[model samples]
Target: MKAIKVAILDLYDGHPNQGMRGFKEILDRYKAKHNLNLVYQVFDVRGKAEVPDLNFDAYISSGGPGSPVDSEGSVWEQRYWELIDKITACNQQADSVKKHVFFVCHSFQLMCRRLQLGEISLRHSPSFGVLPVHQTALGRQEVIFEGLHDPFYAVDSRSWQVTHPDEDNLKKYGAVLLAIEKERPYVDYPRAMMAIRFNDYFFGTQFHPEANPVGMKAHLINEEKKQQVISEHGERKYDEMIERLEDPGMIRLTQSTMIPNFLDQAILSMQEA
Candidate 1:
């Protein structure tokens, strides 16, 4: 069998954080566990002028720190747009082989903007910690959600989200909303789109399904981050988050499945092609 060529586009300009490192480690484990030849490479897409050729079987984009629309006109954003365009073109040109794309957080926002499938804007209150999200009707039938819970927990820490998604646009582009935020008690938050699928070969999650829960626990409790959370959301909210993160079942169930499922689907697609 040919080795699955996977390209991980690291949008972070500097050193990858523990969460990013954890994601890579999980991918490596998946490669070994599935007994598959997986060749993984990372590219820094911060200031590049050209999009590298879309020759990989699967492409994954990492989350960054801000709104994708706000980063418009910057070199990094331009390159990202170019990369997506190339991927779309490649899929269009290919008859039997379709390159797969998996976007996380910021990249998901960027994809939504580039595709014009929704509006992206700052959230009134940032979502942080393991959020409970429920799959839509289409999501339940999607391959990625197979063997996963109906309502699953996923790590989230973002100030921007897809709001008022254009359903018509999504369908026109062969995209579908897979999951959305479950309402929280007493919290009148806007309904945020949690996952999206563009055709059979492209998918994205607004939450960090790639995030390692144990690593995320440590990340949240870091002195600097903890202090920031307390200052921003109040001590009570910070305490609540800390308590929620301690649930071993939620953490384990949330972190264990997403990447593996994505890899399984991508590998099957390659083999069938």
Candidate 2:
């Protein structure tokens, strides 16, 4: 079989702690574990005038720091929106290869906003750290969450979230809400949407399933970031995050299955095709 080509839409431009690296590492592991042929390419979409025209079996959108709404009028944002439009258009064609898209964090918010399936709002306080998320009734039936436990812990860092998801709109689009926040720990905001499925081939997650626990520990331990977290969420929360990072089980519980499951599904699809 030919190698499965995958595209990673990297939103962060040369950040030292880029999440795409973790994603690539996870996918590479998956390929080796399954003995499947898979290839991936990264496209940095920041300040770009045009999106790349390349054919791929799957696309993964990486998370970035910043509010997606704040970037609405920017050149990079507009270009990305156009790119997503093109992807959506292609998916609508009968002859086109079914394109799979996995959106994370900022990209997840962007997709929800563009589809008009949810409301994105700024939170009174930023959410940063591992959070407990519960699978919805529909989520339990989804293949992506297979073998994963309920009330799993996943890394979360966002200033905004999908506040009031339009369930009617989601159903109209043939989408399902996969997961939701178990509790509103910060800002007393209502429970936030954790995951959603727009279709069989498109999904989004509000948390960083690609983030490695070791990498997260390194990122969180940076002196500047530690102080920043302390400033934003106080010293106690920061300390808790440090403590949580030490437990490998806690880090591996929820996030380890995400990319692997997505890739396994893609492989199965290709084999069937």
What tens digits encode model 2's per-residue C-alpha lDDT throughout 1-273? Answer: 687888888887556554887898888887888787788888888635435564778888888877778777788888888777777887787776667788998889988988888888997678888777899998999888887778777888888889788978898899899999877466566888999998878899998888788778888788998898899889999888888777765656555688788877766665666
* TM-score of each predicted structure versus truth: 0.90, 0.91
Best by lDDT: 2
Alpha-carbon RMSD of each model:
2.2, 2.2
User: TM-score of model 1 relative to the true fold?
Assistant: 0.90
Give the lowest summed-lDDT range of ten residues in model 1: 46-55
lDDT of 1 at 65: 77
Residue 195 of model 2, lDDT score: 94
Model 2 / residue 138 / CA error / Å: 0.7
Q: TM-score of predicted model 2?
A: 0.91
Score each candidate by Cα lDDT: 0.79, 0.81
Clashes of 1: 0
